[model samples]
Target: MSIQIGQALPDLDVDVVEDGAPARRMSTASLLGQGRVVLFAVPGAFTPTCSDHHLPGYVQHFEAFRELGVGVVGMAVNDVYVMQAWAAVQQVPPGMKLLADGNGGFARALGLEFDGTAYGMGLRARRFALYAEDGVVRQLHVEAPGEFRVSTAEAVLQALKAPEAGTTG
Candidate 1:
Protein backbone atom coordinates (compact mmCIF):
# COMPACT_ATOMS: atom_id res chain seq x y z
CA MET A 1 0.00 0.00 0.00
CA SER A 2 2.96 2.26 0.02
CA ILE A 3 3.26 5.02 -2.51
CA GLN A 4 4.60 4.02 -5.91
CA ILE A 5 6.05 5.40 -9.05
CA GLY A 6 3.89 7.81 -11.06
CA GLN A 7 1.98 8.76 -7.91
CA ALA A 8 2.13 12.33 -6.76
CA LEU A 9 3.30 12.77 -3.22
CA PRO A 10 0.55 13.00 -0.66
CA ASP A 11 -0.17 16.45 0.65
CA LEU A 12 0.53 16.44 4.35
CA ASP A 13 1.79 19.22 6.57
CA VAL A 14 5.11 18.58 8.25
CA ASP A 15 7.42 20.79 10.28
CA VAL A 16 10.56 22.21 8.67
CA VAL A 17 13.73 23.39 10.28
CA GLU A 18 15.86 26.16 8.85
CA ASP A 19 18.78 28.13 10.22
CA GLY A 20 18.77 26.08 13.39
CA ALA A 21 15.10 26.80 14.20
CA PRO A 22 11.63 25.68 13.29
CA ALA A 23 10.92 27.52 10.07
CA ARG A 24 7.34 26.66 9.15
CA ARG A 25 4.93 23.93 8.32
CA MET A 26 5.03 22.73 4.73
CA SER A 27 2.99 20.29 2.76
CA THR A 28 4.73 17.30 1.16
CA ALA A 29 3.63 18.39 -2.29
CA SER A 30 5.19 21.82 -2.00
CA LEU A 31 8.32 20.47 -0.37
CA LEU A 32 9.04 17.87 -3.06
CA GLY A 33 7.35 19.63 -5.94
CA GLN A 34 8.74 21.76 -8.76
CA GLY A 35 11.95 19.84 -9.43
CA ARG A 36 13.99 16.77 -8.87
CA VAL A 37 14.15 15.71 -5.26
CA VAL A 38 15.68 12.92 -3.21
CA LEU A 39 13.93 12.37 0.12
CA PHE A 40 15.31 9.91 2.64
CA ALA A 41 13.58 9.03 5.87
CA VAL A 42 14.98 7.48 9.02
CA PRO A 43 13.29 5.88 11.99
CA GLY A 44 14.54 8.48 14.45
CA ALA A 45 16.97 11.27 14.81
CA PHE A 46 20.23 10.61 16.65
CA THR A 47 19.71 6.87 16.48
CA PRO A 48 22.91 4.87 16.00
CA THR A 49 22.70 3.91 12.35
CA CYS A 50 20.92 7.08 11.38
CA SER A 51 23.56 9.31 12.97
CA ASP A 52 26.59 7.23 12.12
CA HIS A 53 25.92 6.14 8.56
CA HIS A 54 22.61 7.03 6.90
CA LEU A 55 22.61 10.76 7.48
CA PRO A 56 26.35 11.15 7.11
CA GLY A 57 26.28 9.53 3.69
CA TYR A 58 23.82 12.12 2.50
CA VAL A 59 25.80 14.95 4.02
CA GLN A 60 28.94 13.71 2.33
CA HIS A 61 27.27 13.34 -1.04
CA PHE A 62 25.08 16.45 -0.74
CA GLU A 63 27.13 18.35 -3.25
CA ALA A 64 26.90 15.52 -5.73
CA PHE A 65 23.13 15.52 -5.41
CA ARG A 66 23.04 19.26 -5.84
CA GLU A 67 25.28 18.92 -8.82
CA LEU A 68 22.62 16.80 -10.41
CA GLY A 69 20.07 19.53 -9.65
CA VAL A 70 18.40 17.29 -7.13
CA GLY A 71 17.36 18.56 -3.74
CA VAL A 72 18.11 16.29 -0.81
CA VAL A 73 15.86 16.11 2.22
CA GLY A 74 16.13 14.13 5.42
CA MET A 75 13.03 13.19 7.37
CA ALA A 76 12.21 11.50 10.66
CA VAL A 77 9.21 11.12 12.95
CA ASN A 78 10.84 13.11 15.69
CA ASP A 79 9.86 16.69 16.46
CA VAL A 80 11.45 19.76 14.89
CA TYR A 81 13.67 20.37 17.90
CA VAL A 82 15.34 17.00 17.60
CA MET A 83 15.69 17.40 13.86
CA GLN A 84 17.32 20.76 14.39
CA ALA A 85 19.76 19.26 16.85
CA TRP A 86 20.55 16.40 14.51
CA ALA A 87 21.08 18.78 11.65
CA ALA A 88 23.44 20.78 13.75
CA VAL A 89 25.35 17.72 14.81
CA GLN A 90 25.51 16.35 11.31
CA GLN A 91 26.43 19.74 9.90
CA VAL A 92 23.81 19.41 7.24
CA PRO A 93 24.66 21.38 4.16
CA PRO A 94 22.84 24.54 3.14
CA GLY A 95 20.79 23.10 0.34
CA MET A 96 19.75 20.00 2.25
CA LYS A 97 16.58 20.05 4.34
CA LEU A 98 15.58 18.09 7.41
CA LEU A 99 11.90 17.60 8.12
CA ALA A 100 10.04 16.73 11.28
CA ASP A 101 7.21 14.38 10.55
CA GLY A 102 5.86 14.57 14.06
CA ASN A 103 3.09 12.08 14.76
CA GLY A 104 4.12 10.05 11.70
CA GLY A 105 1.28 11.56 9.71
CA PHE A 106 3.24 11.79 6.49
CA ALA A 107 4.64 8.30 6.85
CA ARG A 108 1.22 6.88 7.54
CA ALA A 109 -0.15 8.62 4.49
CA LEU A 110 2.54 6.95 2.42
CA GLY A 111 1.78 3.63 4.06
CA LEU A 112 5.35 3.61 5.31
CA GLU A 113 4.83 3.89 9.02
CA PHE A 114 5.97 1.00 11.19
CA ASP A 115 5.17 0.06 14.76
CA GLY A 116 8.44 0.42 16.64
CA THR A 117 6.73 0.02 20.00
CA ALA A 118 8.48 -3.33 20.45
CA TYR A 119 11.70 -1.35 20.62
CA GLY A 120 10.02 1.24 22.83
CA MET A 121 10.26 3.65 19.91
CA GLY A 122 6.58 4.02 19.09
CA LEU A 123 5.44 4.84 15.57
CA ARG A 124 8.22 5.66 13.14
CA ALA A 125 9.07 5.99 9.50
CA ARG A 126 10.80 3.11 7.80
CA ARG A 127 14.26 3.64 6.40
CA PHE A 128 13.77 4.50 2.77
CA ALA A 129 14.58 6.90 -0.02
CA LEU A 130 12.75 8.07 -3.09
CA TYR A 131 13.53 10.06 -6.20
CA ALA A 132 10.86 12.29 -7.55
CA GLU A 133 10.54 14.75 -10.33
CA ASP A 134 7.88 17.45 -10.50
CA GLY A 135 6.04 15.74 -7.66
CA VAL A 136 5.82 12.27 -9.17
CA VAL A 137 7.92 9.44 -7.86
CA ARG A 138 10.46 8.05 -10.30
CA GLN A 139 12.33 5.62 -8.09
CA LEU A 140 11.77 4.30 -4.60
CA HIS A 141 14.25 2.33 -2.50
CA VAL A 142 12.91 0.91 0.72
CA GLU A 143 15.17 -0.95 3.08
CA ALA A 144 14.26 -4.23 4.69
CA PRO A 145 13.61 -4.55 8.40
CA GLY A 146 16.84 -4.17 10.40
CA GLU A 147 18.74 -3.70 7.17
CA PHE A 148 20.34 -0.82 5.36
CA ARG A 149 21.46 -1.13 1.79
CA VAL A 150 19.32 0.06 -1.09
CA SER A 151 18.47 3.39 0.53
CA THR A 152 21.97 4.62 1.03
CA ALA A 153 23.12 7.74 -0.75
CA GLU A 154 25.44 5.78 -3.03
CA ALA A 155 22.70 3.39 -4.08
CA VAL A 156 20.31 6.19 -4.92
CA LEU A 157 23.00 8.07 -6.76
CA GLN A 158 23.80 5.03 -8.84
CA ALA A 159 20.15 4.53 -9.65
CA LEU A 160 19.78 8.13 -10.70
CA LYS A 161 22.78 7.83 -12.93
CA ALA A 162 21.65 4.59 -14.51
CA PRO A 163 20.09 4.90 -17.93
CA GLU A 164 17.47 2.24 -17.23
CA ALA A 165 16.60 3.21 -13.70
CA GLY A 166 12.90 3.01 -12.94
CA THR A 167 10.50 2.43 -10.08
CA THR A 168 11.89 0.02 -7.50
CA GLY A 169 10.64 -1.33 -4.18
Candidate 2:
Protein backbone atom coordinates (compact mmCIF):
# COMPACT_ATOMS: atom_id res chain seq x y z
CA MET A 1 0.00 0.00 0.00
CA SER A 2 1.03 3.58 -0.59
CA ILE A 3 2.09 5.79 2.23
CA GLN A 4 -0.79 7.42 4.04
CA ILE A 5 -1.59 10.39 6.20
CA GLY A 6 0.04 10.28 9.65
CA GLN A 7 2.85 7.91 8.61
CA ALA A 8 6.43 9.08 8.67
CA LEU A 9 8.18 9.13 5.33
CA PRO A 10 10.58 6.27 4.71
CA ASP A 11 14.10 7.09 5.76
CA LEU A 12 15.84 6.21 2.53
CA ASP A 13 18.91 7.79 1.03
CA VAL A 14 18.42 10.26 -1.84
CA ASP A 15 20.93 12.45 -3.57
CA VAL A 16 20.43 16.18 -3.56
CA VAL A 17 21.66 17.70 -6.80
CA GLU A 18 22.83 21.29 -7.06
CA ASP A 19 24.84 23.40 -9.50
CA GLY A 20 25.14 20.47 -11.86
CA ALA A 21 26.69 18.30 -9.20
CA PRO A 22 25.73 15.85 -6.52
CA ALA A 23 25.80 18.01 -3.43
CA ARG A 24 25.18 15.37 -0.83
CA ARG A 25 23.54 12.09 0.07
CA MET A 26 21.11 12.31 2.91
CA SER A 27 18.33 10.24 4.37
CA THR A 28 14.76 11.40 3.64
CA ALA A 29 14.23 11.62 7.35
CA SER A 30 16.97 14.22 7.67
CA LEU A 31 16.04 16.13 4.56
CA LEU A 32 12.31 16.39 5.22
CA GLY A 33 12.03 15.36 8.82
CA GLN A 34 12.14 18.69 10.54
CA GLY A 35 9.65 21.00 8.87
CA ARG A 36 6.66 21.37 6.63
CA VAL A 37 7.46 20.16 3.13
CA VAL A 38 5.81 19.67 -0.24
CA LEU A 39 7.46 16.81 -2.11
CA PHE A 40 6.36 16.35 -5.71
CA ALA A 41 7.47 13.50 -7.92
CA VAL A 42 7.55 13.32 -11.71
CA PRO A 43 7.43 10.19 -13.82
CA GLY A 44 10.70 11.20 -15.35
CA ALA A 45 12.64 14.40 -15.62
CA PHE A 46 12.54 16.21 -19.00
CA THR A 47 9.40 14.34 -20.07
CA PRO A 48 6.61 16.39 -21.65
CA THR A 49 4.24 17.16 -18.81
CA CYS A 50 6.97 17.24 -16.25
CA SER A 51 9.04 19.77 -18.17
CA ASP A 52 6.18 21.88 -19.46
CA HIS A 53 3.80 22.00 -16.51
CA HIS A 54 4.61 20.09 -13.35
CA LEU A 55 8.06 21.52 -12.77
CA PRO A 56 7.27 25.03 -13.96
CA GLY A 57 4.25 25.20 -11.70
CA TYR A 58 6.45 24.56 -8.72
CA VAL A 59 9.11 26.96 -9.93
CA GLN A 60 6.53 29.69 -10.37
CA HIS A 61 5.15 29.20 -6.91
CA PHE A 62 8.36 28.46 -5.04
CA GLU A 63 8.13 31.69 -3.14
CA ALA A 64 4.57 31.10 -2.10
CA PHE A 65 5.46 27.74 -0.58
CA ARG A 66 8.41 29.29 1.17
CA GLU A 67 6.21 32.07 2.48
CA LEU A 68 4.05 29.42 4.04
CA GLY A 69 7.16 27.98 5.70
CA VAL A 70 7.00 24.89 3.55
CA GLY A 71 10.05 23.77 1.62
CA VAL A 72 9.43 22.56 -1.92
CA VAL A 73 11.25 19.60 -3.44
CA GLY A 74 11.11 17.98 -6.84
CA MET A 75 12.03 14.31 -7.24
CA ALA A 76 12.50 11.94 -10.15
CA VAL A 77 13.82 8.45 -10.75
CA ASN A 78 16.58 9.84 -12.96
CA ASP A 79 20.17 9.96 -11.83
CA VAL A 80 21.85 12.90 -10.15
CA TYR A 81 23.36 14.13 -13.42
CA VAL A 82 20.05 14.31 -15.24
CA MET A 83 18.43 15.96 -12.25
CA GLN A 84 21.21 18.57 -12.14
CA ALA A 85 20.83 19.38 -15.79
CA TRP A 86 17.07 19.68 -15.48
CA ALA A 87 17.45 21.90 -12.49
CA ALA A 88 19.85 24.14 -14.39
CA VAL A 89 17.60 24.32 -17.44
CA GLN A 90 14.53 25.03 -15.36
CA GLN A 91 16.36 27.69 -13.38
CA VAL A 92 15.08 26.07 -10.24
CA PRO A 93 15.27 28.39 -7.27
CA PRO A 94 18.08 28.04 -4.73
CA GLY A 95 15.99 26.98 -1.79
CA MET A 96 14.13 24.28 -3.69
CA LYS A 97 15.79 20.87 -4.04
CA LEU A 98 15.89 18.29 -6.79
CA LEU A 99 16.34 14.71 -5.66
CA ALA A 100 17.93 11.88 -7.62
CA ASP A 101 16.31 8.56 -7.05
CA GLY A 102 18.28 6.80 -9.79
CA ASN A 103 17.21 3.27 -8.99
CA GLY A 104 13.52 3.95 -8.30
CA GLY A 105 14.13 2.73 -4.79
CA PHE A 106 12.38 5.60 -3.12
CA ALA A 107 9.34 5.37 -5.37
CA ARG A 108 9.07 1.65 -4.80
CA ALA A 109 9.36 2.13 -1.09
CA LEU A 110 6.37 4.44 -1.19
CA GLY A 111 4.38 1.96 -3.32
CA LEU A 112 4.31 4.54 -6.12
CA GLU A 113 6.50 2.89 -8.70
CA PHE A 114 5.06 2.15 -12.13
CA ASP A 115 6.45 0.01 -14.91
CA GLY A 116 6.96 2.08 -18.04
CA THR A 117 8.64 -0.63 -20.10
CA ALA A 118 5.89 -0.39 -22.72
CA TYR A 119 6.81 3.23 -23.18
CA GLY A 120 10.50 2.33 -23.27
CA MET A 121 11.03 4.35 -20.09
CA GLY A 122 11.70 1.49 -17.69
CA LEU A 123 10.59 1.85 -14.09
CA ARG A 124 9.45 5.28 -12.99
CA ALA A 125 7.56 7.16 -10.38
CA ARG A 126 3.92 8.05 -10.76
CA ARG A 127 2.97 11.72 -10.80
CA PHE A 128 2.26 12.51 -7.19
CA ALA A 129 2.63 15.06 -4.44
CA LEU A 130 2.58 14.85 -0.70
CA TYR A 131 2.43 17.32 2.15
CA ALA A 132 4.36 16.37 5.26
CA GLU A 133 4.97 18.03 8.55
CA ASP A 134 7.98 17.07 10.65
CA GLY A 135 8.27 13.80 8.73
CA VAL A 136 4.65 12.63 8.97
CA VAL A 137 2.43 12.83 5.94
CA ARG A 138 -0.62 15.09 6.18
CA GLN A 139 -1.91 14.81 2.62
CA LEU A 140 -1.08 12.94 -0.57
CA HIS A 141 -2.25 13.41 -4.15
CA VAL A 142 -1.43 10.70 -6.64
CA GLU A 143 -2.61 11.57 -10.13
CA ALA A 144 -4.59 9.15 -12.22
CA PRO A 145 -2.66 7.62 -15.08
CA GLY A 146 -2.14 10.09 -17.96
CA GLU A 147 -4.02 12.80 -16.09
CA PHE A 148 -3.01 15.86 -14.15
CA ARG A 149 -5.15 17.89 -11.77
CA VAL A 150 -5.07 17.28 -8.03
CA SER A 151 -1.27 17.18 -7.81
CA THR A 152 -0.77 20.61 -9.27
CA ALA A 153 0.89 23.32 -7.27
CA GLU A 154 -2.33 25.32 -7.19
CA ALA A 155 -4.29 22.40 -5.80
CA VAL A 156 -1.76 21.67 -3.07
CA LEU A 157 -1.64 25.33 -2.13
CA GLN A 158 -5.37 25.48 -1.89
CA ALA A 159 -5.44 22.39 0.29
CA LEU A 160 -2.83 23.87 2.56
CA LYS A 161 -4.96 26.96 3.03
CA ALA A 162 -8.10 25.03 3.85
CA PRO A 163 -9.24 24.88 7.46
CA GLU A 164 -9.59 21.08 7.39
CA ALA A 165 -7.19 19.75 4.75
CA GLY A 166 -6.23 16.29 5.92
CA THR A 167 -7.98 14.44 3.13
CA THR A 168 -5.83 12.61 0.56
CA GLY A 169 -6.57 12.41 -3.15
Clashing pairs in 1: none
Badly placed stretches (over 4 Å) of model 1 are none
Instruction: Report the error of model 1 at residue 119, Å.
Output: 0.6
Candidate 1: count the clashes: 0
TM-score of 1: 0.96
Q: How does each model score on lDDT?
A: 0.90, 0.90
| Candidate 2: regions farther than 4 A off | 19-21
Model 2 Cα lDDT, one tens digit per residue, 1-169: 8888889899999999755555689999988899999999999999999999999999999999999999998999999888988999999988899989999999999998999999999999999999999999989889989988888999899989982766555
TM-score per model over all chains: 0.96, 0.96
At residue 5, give the lDDT of candidate 1: 84
